[model samples]
Target: MSGKDTGHGTQRLALPGVFTAEQAAVTAAAIAGIQRADGAIPWFRGHHLDPWDHIEAAMALDAAGDHRRAAAAYHWLARHQLPDGSWYAAYADGDATRPTDRGKETNFCAYVAAGVLHHYLATGDEEFRERMWPVVYAAVEFVLELQREGGEIGWRRDPDGSACDGALLTGCSSIHQALRCALALAELRDDPQPDWELATGRLGHALRHHPECFLDKSSYSMDWYYPVLAGALRGAAGRARIEDRWPEFVVEGLGVRCVSTNPWVTGGESAELALALWAVGDSERAARVLRWIGHLRAPDGLYWTGYVYADEAIWPRERTAWTAGSVLLAVAALTGDEATGAVFGGAGLPRGLEAEECCDRS
Candidate 1:
């Protein structure tokens, strides 16, 4: 099936031995059903809502032909934004007013730019762009303030309002992608943000050249692959990085491990690794990964977060919207969805001034 839904921008989002267009639609509908009346998507029905995963689920909805629900998710972020342009890390799903976690994570705040750009590219909705521009602008500005002298972004601002000390490689790499998306939107509106462009270039430099600037969470697969997945690292360099660590994090018949030391294989990490694999032009391996993780798909159309292969069980014993969201994104990338490729493929996004070209503010 071409996944030619009656909606705009539909395409063949199916992968052989993985999921069909009809099955993809069922998954999308299940995610839409998870949305609260106000459009915030939590981890699941009883779970807490975080800004980043909320947007991930929203982007998946767009991929699967549910743009209305995706737009609603973005609107919810706009409504919940604090005065300083950040959102509290976790909100109680049952009651939006109750914040379960008070820290403001820079990466989580910056992700709205990527999500907004993806939605706009998928739907080409002018009014939606106009409505979300301020949201994107403010959120990007909020995250940029956390950038360090070395170009790595500070991880979070605490509940007491002070910036956290060290930077995370995974988080900074993710911000690197978000900045590109933000700069793309800036150019689209005929309003170029030179500062953002410089920031993007600097962050890319940091991710590529200065791994020491970030805290060494080398045990986690995210820190290993996010640089490639987020577009900071590519070409032969990206391929080598992935190949070097393939043995440590991958479980052959299972998927990518959340941590090298754990016997657990996770859906989200595996799906994200597949996206990174696609980014590096290793589509065959990427498709293999997507197929490998299909065993985690539950009958409800949501994927179980991960399987503890050693224990023969799914730990955390939970299903998450982000896992489902990531799987769909990987499928969209594999199926050659135009918007998915545009955002994740790094061909059309503006590369900011290299770190040498810009005056250092940090």
Candidate 2:
């Protein structure tokens, strides 16, 4: 399907009997509404411009047939990126903003490479790929510099060049996927990538076997499923890890929680869980995860930030761009649909040594 073809896009992937055509139209319109005229997408209604969340919402826009806007959003990131291959933690509208003088976040910085790669794939724009390569290369270098002794990546870099000691399993896992995508892009363009290969392998090894080396944020849904979803975990062991935590983190028809005990279920986590479940060959379970969040949809096709457990009303009571994007991605995965094949289509799992082979073999 061409990028211009809107008929088979995200609109059609909505849950059966769940979202109507009118609802999907509202959702698409809502996404478009958050997009700035300059092509940047904000996370919420007003001036909330976060890079990671913005890229995520842009991906959804591409899925919904807004490639021009998605490309513009990427261009905006390129324009704003620091020379050291990082962005501030946050940005205020029409002004450069930063919480600290920090250079870049490991997770947030790594994510844009995937977004660029996705844009290239969806649109097949060679010029865009060429323009984006420098950004991808520089960002990967920044991430590699922060890698710790045991192969795990640090969380973020302070402006003074100091690193956060604790690593997050979820963050590293996402970076692993980004690294692979970067490597793939490098190879596609016939560029040399020996360093990328080595770094990617090391990071993948850390994710597969060295959870102890990272911060123990295992109580969260991201930590639970990111290994699988991020393409860092594979085979029998990967399957086992997901199965072990499945019951603990999932709350039946409600959705997945940010933390297992948080009593708040969110669209992003639920959709992410669906992607992870699909990776492990559990389409039935993946579909269930998607369905769990279907009811969270607002009349505008957007979703509330999260669902409150007590009243079951939407908590934060605000529609979120990323939340709607998450639902679109989950629905795409569940329905075997792809508005843009570039959007992380279940590329099996990461290649090379299994978790057991990496950790236990003599």
Candidate 3:
């Protein structure tokens, strides 16, 4: 065997705490086990599927070496996309039925861009990218239409085409990231977006300086870290923001709460916080965040949605496929693991603007 192989050998690395390689293998096996023959991955064993969770499951499949299954999931998305280039918010289990209208959530629709980009990276299929471009383009246009006068984006649009009540910093931040990915994909395919740079800059500026325009959601974890996470805040300002809210949202050994006053900590928020920390180059604290959720992993490798306050065993034990996927993506980023290079190693901040321009626009 090569020297590199000799050093690392074939020993399976343990996840957090008690999870051995054997356990991880079983967890991965279980995820695959839940995947339907047509490529739909249900959130849990025998449960129904939703678009957001389905895409998340597909990502996990890629991480676990089930590219074929992942591709099938993408194909599923492609087949069901609305004429406006969005997927329904939720779908029935196993089969695509009982579609629920989530009223055009920008983040929900934007998420597909990242997944399609990731799938293309994983498979290197030019045809797949070609097929997805029109969907991606139309979706971006749909989100752009929701941008308000002051540069902040509305959270969603109602089914009748009316705007949702207010803006969410977190939702907009996620959409900002997705927009960048969409633009990157556009560039990669030699179909650069004409106004993408300006639109992204406007959104970033609004997030950094125009907090008054958005709803007063400072207590929420998404509001706390999203600016930095979205690449809208950077350098000294980003660092300061995280430091200011660290104690309020972070719950020591349990991870981060979705909101400071809620006293409920969730795996998704914790993992996402780790992601924000990673974006700002704080790998040490990022690792700590990951370790917090690492302690919460079930024997099946899935993660419970949230943990209850004042008691460890009283936590909500329902596993979410997105929670596990977020944790995996965070861990990969923290460790600089090349196997997950595409997902974790994207350009740190959104390109095409200076930090001053991004943060100081009036």
Candidate 4:
């Protein structure tokens, strides 16, 4: 609320014990420092921009009470949206808006809806929501255009416009959550997208039952937990899913591993798992998981990407906006930020149209 007007009334983000007010402010400042004048937030100051991470950082900025900047970040996305409603996989360096990776990632395209809705929820910014609706709607169309008949969305589209043959568990799960947010936006506008709802329900079915549709990536922590975090799986089933992979992905007294074979425990993944845990009504476990990652926090309140257990050091010394952003989001969810809580805990967001059947065997 302290920030300049973005044509929408200003409102501050919720601050809870997820981190002290001081620590939260410090993290916010750190994030703000990396935001480009054009509103692009790269992974690090000199690093490239991925749309998903860019939005993550923007959300953190919003949580930190930098409302105008957060709104600017969304505007950046709207300004740069490709003709096809997608963005290149990566935009290199803040110095220019060039794409480092020209591939259009499916989940990355879909994520804009989640970001737009979260911003609207936090600020009650009707104008912001209205302006960004076309961007969100187009991004959703781009994502679902690649969804297969079996209900799994293809993972990416190459520069030449060919879709990737296989789906990814993590990416598809995230898209499921994004699709729900898109539905919520559509409903809010009184312009329901039945196709989106059906696609979402089908995508959810694929995420929960058709593992075969996605490339097998059991070793990666994201594949193990994102379904729960993304709301594709919930209740006892969700809790059981995390328990099923707990031993493989979580490092006791440390944090969640980036991969089963790696000695690395990543702050982003760990914080995300904490959010997932909270979504399933396991707040205590979520807090413990989040606390374990404090080891990855830098003196400046910025979080390191991961800690390498074998090296006994932060493997990637660089502080990433997304890593800090994940922590802020997890804390927001824990501290009861209604929008953050609703997004992560799968409340308030549309649940999508239930598929006629759970799984399409064909």
Per TM-score, the best of the predicted structures is 1
What TM-score, over all chains together, does every model reach? Answer: 0.96, 0.89, 0.86, 0.94
Q: How many clashes does each candidate structure show, in the order listed? A: 0, 0, 1, 0
lDDT of 1 by residue, 317-360 (tens): 88888899999899999888878888899789988888776655
Error of 3 at 10 (Å): 12
| lDDT, residue 352, model 4 | 76
The residue-by-residue lDDT of candidate 3 on 1-362, one tens digit each, is 00121112112324455245555455555666677777777676556676666776676565554566667877777777778776665655657665655466777777677777776765677887788888788888878888887777888778787888788888777777777778778888877675776677677777888888788988888899877776667678988999998989999988999878887899888987887888778978887777877666777777888887766553675786777767765655554543344444456323545336656664
Candidate 2 overall lDDT versus native: 0.74
Most accurate candidate by lDDT: 1
Give the least accurate 10-residue stretch of model 3, judged by summed lDDT: 1-10
Candidate 2, number of clashes:
0
Sorted on lDDT, best first, the list reads 1, 4, 2, 3
RMSD vs true structure, all candidates: 2.8, 3.3, 4.7, 3.1
On residues 1-362, what C-alpha lDDT tens digit does candidate 2 reach at each position? 12452333555666664465456556766877877777667777565676778888777766666677778888888888888888877665423443333446788888887888777766788888889898888888888888877778998887777786789999999888888778777877888677667677778878877778899897888998898887777567768988898788888888888888778888889888887777677878887777778778776678877887867677877787888877666665566644333345536323433334545654
Worst 10 residues of 2 by lDDT: 1-10
Q: How accurate locally is residue 215 in candidate 4, as Cα lDDT from 0 to 100?
A: 93
Runs in model 2 lying further than 4 Å from the true structure: 1-8, 17-22, 93-103, 337-343, 346-362
TM-score of candidate 1 against the unseen true structure? 0.96
Q: lDDT per residue, candidate 4, 174-290, as tens digits? A: 999999989989989999798888898888877888889989888999998899999988999999999998998999989999999999999999999999999999988888888
